[model samples]
Target: MSVLQPEVNITAGLQYQGSQEKALVGVLCTGTSCSFLYINSVLLFTLRSKPVFCETSRYILLYNLLFADTAHMVTNVLLFLLAALKIIIAYIPCCVLVLLSGFTDIISPLTLAVMSVERYVAVCHPLRHSAIFTTRSTGTAIALVWAYNFIYILVQVFMLLYVLTKIYIDLHLYDFCSKEAIFSAPIFTKFQQTYHVTVFFAASVTIMVSYIGVAIVAKSASTDRASARKALQTLLLHLIQLSLILTSTFFTTIIAAYATVGRLTLIRVYNVCFVCLNILPRCLSALIYGIKDQNIRPVFMKYLFCQGRSSVILNKK
Candidate 1:
């Protein structure tokens, strides 16, 4: 493949200093495992329950989000392991991983966008929400989201393959395989930039608009005080999660910008930031949204720890 082809010169790049790379690998491993376990526990609990605790539209979105987040975390672990071990990965596995990672990256924000819309409908059209967002419809929506992401990944892969067939681009430009490495080719860089901007823009607009609408509707009704509060909390969580994800993406991109300078100290700082930002949000999302959810928490406690069910705190509708 073109990525590992002989003509593509591998640069001897200097980045992380002693113990820095090791620390990153360790953090990634621990974070990935922790996230996997937590998410798996929630998933299993949901499965084992005679009737799932929260099977609404919002819960469905959250269920899918958990799986997507786990996949994203796993890809990060693989990338970090390759970087730490100094493995010269071949083109096929590298492309597959990068595509998988990128696909999940986009899916996350999109899933959140859908969740925001679900909240909007629940708040703005409570009577019709049930009619519109039935089990079959919600399942179809989630399937559509995955379908859209798969097409996005295929388009990206097609572009890369076409460009590689025509021109010789080096994979060695990046210490780890990422979609950003495509930026090395001027043609692909435009597509990468355009795609990133489009996704971020669309997701941002959907989230902001939907949440604002939900908040407005919730606050308008005196009886919806509890819902208003939950909306606020949910909005904060989504923003926090988005900030962490965007920070990781840009942190990696910015570090690549300074790659030519190859400053060990700079790389070390970014490595720490990258690992923390990437891992913390995954764990926190599970804690804040999954374990802390009023309905889900009781199920989790009962199933995982044999603890008695706690009172549900939020609006179940």
Candidate 2:
């Protein structure tokens, strides 16, 4: 990640606080399609109740990660596929795109916080662990995460599109995976930029700090402090993965904001490269979860690769 000079062509778009532009393409990018399917398939095999040993809480965390990653993938596929299909269809409204892309982008940090909460309960209140981590409770927690994230996205999206649409008027077609879609509305676009920066910063930092609080609680607990430490390590690793994967997306959105003002040359290359890079982590999320969770890796091997045939084939007399 070397520093590149800002394109001279970009105009008033530079007023955006940071990299908060057309980051939508990061979700709409095509490179991650196959990986999403593969990881999702593996998750089905490994996320069963039988293999989830109670000794370590990683199993629970891994299960949550599966949903998050699968969702992240599905949403990505939808966004990109729609972008491509729009070539054959008529005008697709920016508001619809705004809502879809906003929810799709928040999956990374939201799942991280879910894992942290699971670890917190498992470690902090061992007596009530089973009661709290029940199948019903787990489902409730998951539903809340998805709902909250969506609501958060929805509110801001309306704000972003509405404000930007009112102020500026940039009627142009911006192409990503699909043919250039017309954005003939600048005020709406600025609204989008403003909404993106606010949510991006707030969600990312809040989720991260939540995990840190979980880590602190885990450190104070008496039993399974070791597991707590392990969980924290995994959380840190996941956070790092998120930052790396999101690098391009964050930059691309910034580019989009500028490109709206018609600064479209050297910056476009940066946009393309970063947008493509988003898939690397998204597709690899399953592997990251497996690596982070000891229980998950063995289960993945047992079912996915069908290893450990020796125990079944030969009983040593």
Candidate 3:
């Protein structure tokens, strides 16, 4: 999983100075994950509760993005907890978790790329936007994104199994389950690096082109200037979000570069990077669309605050 593939020896940081420190770190990580999960769940519910959100192409895409992020976050936190507690599982189960983590990790940026193009169309080709991105078409795009990642993961699985069958190795892991530990073959490592670089490059180009297109439309007098401006802002956010998501693919490589530093310093740096690059990015979708979007804000707040059925009925009336 891209989330678990921090290029450094992850077990090094898992070894805390004391039990108290370990417990504190686990609590902090778990608490943060739980909070984000709650917000994402509520926002997902909000997206589903209304017909407007249901029929809107962008909202459907947003739901897909949030779902992928939530799944990735859950698997990531599970792996972290397992490492922290020194729990060792069988080889097959670890492979399942690792592959699942990788799938969810890769899907977000692809979904963002599609969302960017959707926005570009909305701003630059307003007349065709509705026809171009109906709910069915939006769903098909999402399915294609998922299918692409699924095929990639399926290839990795076949390669891993082939390697295992040819080699003499223990069925149980000697260390914490991670991509590096499980898929340790030189070929697997090289393939993953190449794949991540390719995907990141492609997503980057898609988003940049979309941003430039929207910016051009915003400057044109014939365009809906207000809508174009809003899209430009949204695309800018997508770029930031994309950078954060893709940065995680290199978390291990970045940390490994500094591996020669003192143990205490490295631990601190690893913890900070893990939280910033891995955990926090998964929650930004909720913050960006759940809170920032005007259309979703009222309904989101009503559910978030536990407004009663009476309030909803009154508002609808």
Give the residue spans of candidate 1 off by over 4 A: 1-50, 169-176, 180-183, 260-263, 302-317
lDDT of 1 at 240: 68
Q: What is the C-alpha lDDT of each candidate?
A: 0.69, 0.56, 0.86
Instruction: Pick the TM-score winner.
Output: 3
lDDT of 1 by residue, 166-247 (tens): 8886654446555555435676656656766787778778888877787777667453778767876787678668767766
The reply for model 2, stretches above 4 Å from the true place, is: 1-32, 49-64, 75-88, 93-98, 152-225, 245-251, 257-277, 306-317
Kindly list the per-residue Cα lDDT of model 3 for residues 1-317, writing each as its tens digit: 78767744465556644456757877887788788889988899999998999899999999999999989988888887787788998888999999999989889989999999999999888889999999899999999999999999999989988998999778888877876677878898788889888988898899999999888778878888888878888888988998998888887777777779975566567667768888899999999887779999988888888885768788999
As for lDDT, the candidate ahead, 2 or 3, is: 3
- How do all the candidates rank in terms of lDDT, highest first? 3, 1, 2
The residue-level lDDT of candidate 2 at 140 comes to 72
- Residue 116, candidate 1: Cα error in Å is 0.9
Task: List TM-scores for all candidates, in order.
Answer: 0.79, 0.61, 0.89
Q: Which is the better candidate, 1 or 3, if ranked by TM-score?
A: 3
Error of 1 at 315 (Å): 34
